[model samples]
Target: MSSLLDVEVKETIDQKTFLTFDLDKETFAVEVEKVVEIQELTNITPIPNAPKHMAGVQNLRGKILPLIDTKVKFGLDPIKETVDTCIVVIEMEVEGEKTLVGTLVDAVQEVVTVPSAEIQSSPSIDAKFDLDFVSGMFKKGDKFIMLLNLDKTFALDEGDAADNKENQSHAKSKKS
Candidate 1:
């Protein structure tokens, strides 16, 4: 009885769980082990002179957690916050320290269990944003969900993000 239930729960030996979210119509996922929690969109204190991709900071319990706009970070246009908009709090390693950052997503999908063999390397293709942050991907139904490398995607280098945006703008101007 009890043993049977335990065996059923332990069936995912070769499977990993991921927390999925949506931005625009594309889907993205991160390992559930890296996700701390999810919260509905809350009042965010805007930071002065912060990078455009940064949404600002929010109070998580008693700690101040910085928030990043996932769409903006991926070079996608930011959409107005709706009822489905929420924050996915993820634990990332930064400068040898463990830190928590809240990422804003259009909507959270659900936890999905994927077999290890199903995950594939992302193909090199022209995309709106750099695919370096995508660690892997897997096709589901008619859509492919990219798995994000939390550390790379949410690196807390404010100056580097601003510099990258500036450099991209310069390149675009030069092309004109």
Candidate 2:
């Protein structure tokens, strides 16, 4: 699979690789360029001082990689992961460098090709989950799959996480 050199910042492309998956009974698609590799659920090594959304790191073919639980990022209750859960390894171009990140999906459906014309801009969403993370919506049959901006979804940096922890800790300390 070839990495689309500029999918992170630019959204003006025609054909796109859609990796569809189920999230809370809804289907979502992340650009295929964002996906490094899809693998069956594997053991994750927890890292201290890591972001809360971070599920931990996993070893894929001897590579240590970070795993982010999308549920946590979206402010939803964490789903009890089962054997069916698989990690979708994503490689994103962040700040001019390609970084690898993984998100655990309930189940991966398939990789389908959809032209850019079929993707429609995000409509106003009234949920706590940020709609900006969604690039567009694609319809298949009576169902619609939200095409996700994986890079934007899992794009938190260490500095941002540290600042968040500081704020959280300050808020906690004041509660005492």
Candidate 3:
């Protein structure tokens, strides 16, 4: 048999396992290592000056993190009070730094381990929702769990990003 050592074969891929959650009828997931904790649905303090998708702030063990509605981010209908809603707190790394961010979902399913071999780059999805936030897709059993690139999902535009950078820098200085 002829040897086949192509570039794709020579390169190794880095994959992190993730936990799946449901929104509307679709299933999705984010890196498990990035996830801090999944909290039950609770009162979130609305922020008067926050962005449209931001549900508001929440205090977890004395640490504050912005709670973002996945429905809002995906342009879904407004969420009504339900028994299954929850907040999946994820720690994301953006621009070479890490911070905690919580995402509200319709319901959270059990965690499913996805192997690196099972992941593939996602293609252009229909424009109904922004697909740029999706890093890839992984299949387990008969389900497809869209892997969210949290960094890209939380990517802020110039002004807001600049404000975040300033805040981060100040925080860094205080720490040092």
How well is each residue in 1-176 modelled by candidate 2, as lDDT tens digits?
A: 44677664355456688889987778899877677788877778877656667788987678778888887777676656877788888888888988788888888999988767888988896955678678789888799999887667878866547956876787788889
TM-scores vs. true structure, each candidate: 0.83, 0.79, 0.77
The lDDT leader among the candidates is 1
Q: Give lDDT: candidate 1, residue 34.
A: 93
Summing lDDT over every window of 10 consecutive residues in candidate 2, give the lowest-scoring window: 6-15
Error of 1 at 102 (Å): 0.3
- Is candidate 1 or 2 superior in lDDT? 1
lDDT of 3 by residue, 19-97 (tens): 8998878888887888889888887998754555778898888978888887777778756658899899988776788
Q: Write down the TM-score for model 2.
A: 0.79
- Model 2, position 19: C-alpha lDDT score: 86
Q: What are the clashing pairs of model 2?
A: none
Worst 10 residues of 3 by lDDT: 6-15
Native-vs-model 3 lDDT? Answer: 0.77
Backbone clash pairs in model 2 (N, Cα, C under 3 Å; residues 3+ apart or in different chains), count = 0
Ranked candidates, highest TM-score first: 1, 2, 3
**Against the unseen true structure, what C-alpha lDDT does each candidate score?**
0.86, 0.79, 0.77
